[model samples]
Target: MQSFEIDKSDLLRIKNALEDNDAELQRVLLQYHTSEIAILFEKLQPDERERIINVLPTGEASEVIAEMDEEHHPAELLVNLTPEKRSEIVEELDYDDATDLLSQLDESDQQQILRDIDQEDASNIRALLNYDEDTAGGLMNTDLIKVNGKLNKNEALEEIIRQSEEMEEFYTLYAVNDDDILLGILSIKDIIKAKKEVTVLELVNKEFVYVKVDLDQEEVAKLISQYNLTSIPVVNDDMKLLGRITVDDIIDVMEEENTEDILKISGVSEDEELSGGWRNAVKSRLPWLVINLGTAFLAASVIRSYEDTAAKLPIISAYMIIIAGMGGNAATQALAVTVRRISLSDLTDRQAYITVVKEFLVGMTNGATNGVIVAAVANWYDSNPMLGLVMFLAMTGNLIIAGLTGATIPLILKRVGIDPAVASSIIITTFTDCIGFLLPLWLATKLLL
Candidate 1:
């Protein structure tokens, strides 16, 4: 197979062909895989994408839609197709994928699409849709191979063969009792090696990791990554098997959770779409900026209080910015590390204490090193050793404060049930800015004045 990049030229060629209704060019698109075709959808206009989707085979079109980004509104493309074509594509989608697409549409649209699918698939999709989209149940797929533990090895093998024929892949076969309660998981290797007369109960491994339906998807991904599992089973309150969440779904959850954290850390709303209109971007960002402005006023007030001292020694104005900027940078360093640690797991009292102490020491050491360098530069610039000494002391004090506050704020927020990522940055900025400006000005007032 050959690979080709879908560049502007290729998009232009496809666009021109579609505009002209070029039959030969349309046939060439059929040769590309569904994933490649999906990429083309992103570059093409909505009408062109709809035309191509309508022209493709139903199964291929369904796969192409599935391959597109959920945020791109792939469900809208399905709406453009005729009812018969829409029904065919919807029927071909995996239950989880179909449910995800439908959930993105309006309630009436969701119901209309659901009515087109088979009764059994519709019921399964409805059941999945009932769970929170960030929970284990929502991430799981109903397509899995299961066998009764009471069955003989040959019977189990036959059942597995029958069940997996429609599935693209299977990693492990789940063994359940008559009540459909999950008993154990059997690896494919073990099943293949079992004697013909052996029972599945004899071969199944009872020690297996699984998640409850309500478990958060982040925790689900953590469990899968921690245990090195390709797929983890989902169970109800009674321990009845519901479905399996594969590694692919876990990857998606990881990406989403990471994106949300990054946005929150920057004081931006996670719900803000990257490709959304400027209006939405402003709406999502304005509140945080307002809070930041208020904090800026507070920092400015600190400077206003020291105006007499600044006016007396005008050179102090220049040094004030240097000290405050360095302090803010140091605090941000500590904040980043602390936020990541909190995300990994809940810290014990001992761990939290250790974290604070470590950051404090780091702050002290780094502050001393940087303060000495800046102190030397100040003395050289102003030819005043006393001025150097004052800067050194002020920088050292501000950095220690920075380190302490940065390390503690996020942990404190976590304790109070607040999302550390959301508010920690603003609070740390205020602490660093106020202290950063106040220390040098106050010191210069007493020493240099």
Candidate 2:
């Protein structure tokens, strides 16, 4: 399919079609893919979105809703739909998409909507809702092709044909026992190339990677990425096949996880929507800002204790800001790298130790390089070798402190079960700032005072 972007002119045409109650609106919308329509919904008001959804066929509407970003509030859009239309759209959606939308609603709303859909679909959705939204079970769809492993190749093919009637597409077929215990997997090629009498069990690739139902979605993404899999089976504790998670779902999970990490690193809550109102923005961000302010005072207290030294040498105060700012920036660089590594996988004790040591050496080298430049500037300005020495010592010491705290704190937080991304920046900032201020002032007192 060709790529398409909804430019301003396209938006204007779409809006005009909606405004005029034009029958051509469907035609205009049909030109865009369902994903594009979903993007367009983000630009529309609630009522406008409702109108467009109402105008489309139920299956298309369902696809558009499924394609929407969660921040667009797809659940609210479903609620705004008329009950009969809502049920139709819900029924048209895949089990995973329908469950995700309903999970965002209140229990009463979810139940009411579930009652109106197919009993089997509702049951599958309820089963999925029981898992945390960030787990493999929640990410999987119950709609997939599976065949009895005891079946001969021809019988398995017939069974696949029967089961595939309900599914839109499938890349791999799961092999299960009579009790639904997952045995292995079969590619289409494996099935087609085998003799008619060959059993599915004989053809199945038994050594396949799979995830438990409760496995974290991030880990699921990692496994899928590591193995370059198109899909992975989800199983219960007893290895009973529950559902399968497709590559598309993993792609979404990866995007969500990456966005969350980026936001947390910047000290913003992941819940803050990019297009959210100021009130919501404040609600999401104010707490972190308050916490940062509290930490800022700790750095202030360090400066306060050295008031005499700073007062005696006013030039020391100016250099102090430079050192602290540089330290904070350098520490942030280390913290970002460390947090990214931790997120990708749990490091062994040896790996973690090596990581800290690596940052320490990096800090030392960078600190010395920057120190010489600052020391030279200080000597040139004050014509005092002692002041330059103090500056050099302060810069090098604080940077070393920066690297250590930045690398070590995240690993410690991870070990203690804290989200290193959320807490690391705050703690590292406090360390770098306090040490940045204290190092220069104390050195100045000893060497220059």
Candidate 3:
């Protein structure tokens, strides 16, 4: 067995193999990093990689192939394969992974793969593929143990053992009625604790809850956490057990959702990558950047309107920069906190509004306190009383605005079904900048000049 971590030279060798049309050597040469292997598959046109993928083991091979970024259509190669080969890959994939790949393929391609797969696999994939990618159904594993309530303790254990052989270590067993509605759940520990003589129907807990297939993954995660469930069953309209959302998968969903929100708060889109192509990356960000620019100009225009005040007291212009920075930073902090809360829980408009008022007060009191400190710092440097006063007023104003803007934007976005994080940076910064610049000049005009 040969395995080695690839370095620069290995990467070059893999590249050379693709150049030489050595698909055999290419597959063998590039088994080190799954992501890197995906990237290697990108070097050849899809037809070449498609040919290479055919020779590999189904599971590990499928993982490496799945590692390819969806942006690259080296998958076009996958689309051209025989329906049998396409399905061979699809059938071997886990429900979630298969759904991800299948959703990316064209309608006709998906149809062909579905037609070519086993009926059971096809049904499971279709059931999952039908749901939104963010929902529990899409993210959950359909291969879950479900026991009929009529089963006695011995019968249930036997059924669970048979299912375990099929799916392996299924921690949660859903107890369903004849109508297929979820009644409760049984854990592995619960099964083991039962007397061999006790009926499973008597042993299984009936208080456990479940979620619908269409429920958001975030919500599903909350349900699991709140109830302390190892796994939560997902059901369809008929209450037939469609799947179970496992904690491991829920953890992934939570990380993704939180990361997406964090990026959004920073005025970055989910697609912005540190290593993406310059053109693609810039295009993804440029629209929002341009929007941010427009708002910046709006801020500058406010400063422009008070240019005469700044002209009369050049100190106002100098201190305005500090104001803008303080406000923007404060607003970002508030926005991040609120956005994360909304993401994890059901935050009502009223609750958000109340939070806004509290943040405003918090922002104001803290801003005023920081303003006093900044004013003192500025006055210490310049030996001017008015400079200190200007710093204090501007800092207080900006902090107040930052807290309100940061908290409100995401909440509003949620209400509208837009990602709260989208354009959050641009919105919060624009508000803070506009306020930061204008407030100091306006205060200066009234008090200093």
Candidate 4:
């Protein structure tokens, strides 16, 4: 399908339709997909969004709300919806999506909404809500096609057809025992090719990969990507089938995880929303800035200790900033790579050591190349070979330090059970800054004095 891009004209048309109570509103919206409508909701006022939701069919409305980013306050919109309408929408949503929306509300709101939906659906949603949102259980949907392992080809096909009536789409069939323990998986192709006499257990792929419900969502995502699966079964400790996590859910998890890592690396709290207010912005960011300020003071003290060196040769001031900035930039690059690697998978001791060593070599190569250029510039600018030599040595040494710290700090933090992305950048910045300033000045004092 082609991607839809909403424009100013489209917004104006929608607003006009809303104001005039035009019947054209539904027709205009019908042109867009559910996801596209979700995007449009982000641009509309809450009341306008409510009007739009009320106009759409119940199923489509649920999909639009499910597609919406949490920053848009979908839970609040659900609360504003009339009880009967809210129940209709909730019932239409998949248990996973319904759980996510309801979990964002207060306990009372959740209970009230739960009371209105079908008992079975509400029970499924309640079971999902008990899981941590970052786990496999939270990402899985109870909706799936499963057959008893003893069922023959014809019986399995009949079961599938019966089970599939409530589902919009399915990619795989799970084979389970009478006790609901997962036996294996069967593809539609396998079932179609099987002889009438074959049982589901005989046709099932016993080696299929599956994840425990308590597994971290990141690990679940990795397994899905590694195996190139459209969906994977989720089970409990006893291998009892619970639900299946589809590729669509894994895609969302990957996006959320990568966004969270980027935010944490930038010293911003992951909880801070892009659409949040100024007060929330300050509340989320001020603590990190204060910590950074403390680190800056440490660098300043290093500079203070070399007061005489900088005073005697004021030219060192300009060159020092260049050295420090280069070191900080290089460290940041190394830190980004290391943190991303850690996120993708756990590293063994040997692998982690090799990573650090590889980064060290990279730092040396980059440092030597930049050092030569900077040294040439310094020599030409000041007409002093001694000053140039000092610049070369300081630049090379500081970058080496930058590389070592960048790669090593994250690994150490991760070992200590800390999130490498959260603490690595701040710590690496301090190291780069302090060493960046100390290196050039100390070298210049001894060599160029």
Residue-by-residue lDDT tens digits, candidate 2, 232-289: 9999999999999999999999999999999999999998998899999999999999
Record all residue pairs in model 2 with backbone atoms less than 3 Å apart, i.e. clashing: none
Clashes of each: 0, 0, 3, 0
**Two-way lDDT contest, 3 vs 4, winner:** 4
Each prediction's RMSD to truth: 2.0, 1.4, 4.1, 1.0
Residue-level lDDT of model 3, residues 1-449, one tens digit each, is 55444467766776566566556564664556565577666555665576567655666567766666666753565677676677777777777777888888889878888888888988888878888998887888888888888887778878888887856446777888888778777776787787776765676687768788888788888888898878888888777877887787777777777777776776667877645688877877788788877887898799779878878888777778988988988998888788778877768768888989988998999899999999898889989888798789889888998998888887877888887767567778888888988888888888877
* lDDT for model 4: 0.93
Any residue pairs clashing in model 1, and if so which? none
* Most lDDT-accurate candidate: 4
Candidate 2 global lDDT: 0.92
Best by TM-score: 4
Alpha carbon deviation, residue 420, candidate 1 (Å): 0.7
What local lDDT score does residue 225 receive in model 4, on the 0 to 100 scale? Answer: 98
lDDT of 4 by residue, 101-220 (tens): 998999999999999889999999999999998899999999999999999999999999999999999999999998899999989899889999999999988999999999999999
Question: Candidates' lDDT values, in order?
Answer: 0.89, 0.92, 0.77, 0.93
Clashes of 2: 0
Winner of 1 and 3 under lDDT: 1
Error of 3 at 167 (Å): 1.7
